[model samples]
Target: MSALRAPASPGTRPAAAPRRAPLTSLPGGAADRGRRLDAVRAPLQATSGVPFLVLCAVILAGALLAALLLNTSMARGSYEASRLQAEVGHVAQDVQSHQEKLRAAEASLAERATRLGMVPAEDPTMISIEKRAKVGVGEADAGADATLGP
Candidate 1:
């Protein structure tokens, strides 16, 4: 019903939308402080050419890149560690196999020596030396020959 109301007749011309209210300076009230804040924010808004959403996107992209780089480095280190561990395992297996072969060889040598009438000598001090004087050169004394049996 006031001057700002729209026309009721649809057949007539369409009424224009009301103009926005003018900017007004307010007192030191909270609403006035809010307007003052807006007034102070205007220059910052004008100077900040980049939009907030775009800046956030750029920051997110940088963080993602850094994360990706760190992930790649960690993956490479993990692979290297796995490879070294495998190598160590392989070397350990080789050492075990070699030790087994050495034991088998020592056993075989002892068996062959026993077959050929070779035996480990007893304590040299326990043998009597009197028989050594009677035995000719290149001939083993009777006491020494008795000690040589398997």
Candidate 2:
């Protein structure tokens, strides 16, 4: 019967043994065990997305706050600019009114001068001074006579 069994094919290979992991090579190795102990001793680890979501929320809140602040500042600036512009316009109008009042006052003064017998000078005289003339210090008096000719 043994001779009746066909000889094993030289090209065929035997089945390999089922491998078993050693105690140290188990699923929870030293590093995994330490991690497990740390988890038990310390607080639970946060979800992977919790911190990322918190950071996003913080960034979004910051952006909103910045936008609000910027908008408020811009609004204040715009209001101030408009107020100043209005003030400038009022000041300009006041200046124009003052100028008109001054012109009217000047005209009234001229009319009153003419009514009070103040006439424009027909012949205006100017005293001439020559280099050869010796003007004494006492000649500065209003009653002193100074001649223009040398």
Candidate 3:
């Protein structure tokens, strides 16, 4: 049987060993201790509230500025409206003054015509330019009009 022991198969290949990560520093530079090392990290620091406060302040200032501009615009518009109302009142006064003057002038004209002995014609006559003749005899006066009393 020792002589009959099977020879190693020539057709079979040997399996490769599993790959492993190389060890870095371990206390005294120990190798292959089979322990994973923890990674070092930066320490946590406290953040300041100044940047947030500044942002809030800027937004508040912008809102105030917008409100100021809106108020100014409203005030300007109010001033313009008041000015236009005053101008309208002035125009109305001017128109009324002109109307009063016209009335006075009309009355003056009537009185002047009476003083100049210009009387209203009872039987009005017209010379027709187109026909080149007198339109009527015009000798009769107010007798045919029923509205006139004898």
TM-scores, all models, native as reference: 0.43, 0.47, 0.44
Model 2: CA > 4 A from native: 1-47, 114-150
Say which candidate scores most in lDDT: 3
Candidate 2 per-residue lDDT, tens place, 1-150, comes to: 775967679998777899997655457665666654443465577558888999999999999999999999999999999999999999999999999999999879978889999987554434546454435534334464555554
Candidate 1 segments exceeding 4 Å error: 1-45, 49-58, 112-119, 124-150
On TM-score, the candidate that comes out on top is: 2
Ranking 1 against 3 by TM-score, winner: 3
| Candidate closer to the true structure by lDDT (higher is better), 2 or 3 | 3
Model 1 superposed RMSD (Cα): 13.4
Q: What lDDT, from 0 to 1, does candidate 3 have?
A: 0.78
Candidate 3 residue 128 Cα shift, in angstroms, is 17
Q: What Cα-based lDDT does every candidate model obtain?
A: 0.73, 0.76, 0.78
Native-to-model Cα distance after best TM-score fit, residue 122 in candidate 1, in Å: 1.6
TM-score, ranked from best to worst: 2, 3, 1
Candidate 2 — what's its lDDT? Answer: 0.76
TM-score of 1: 0.43
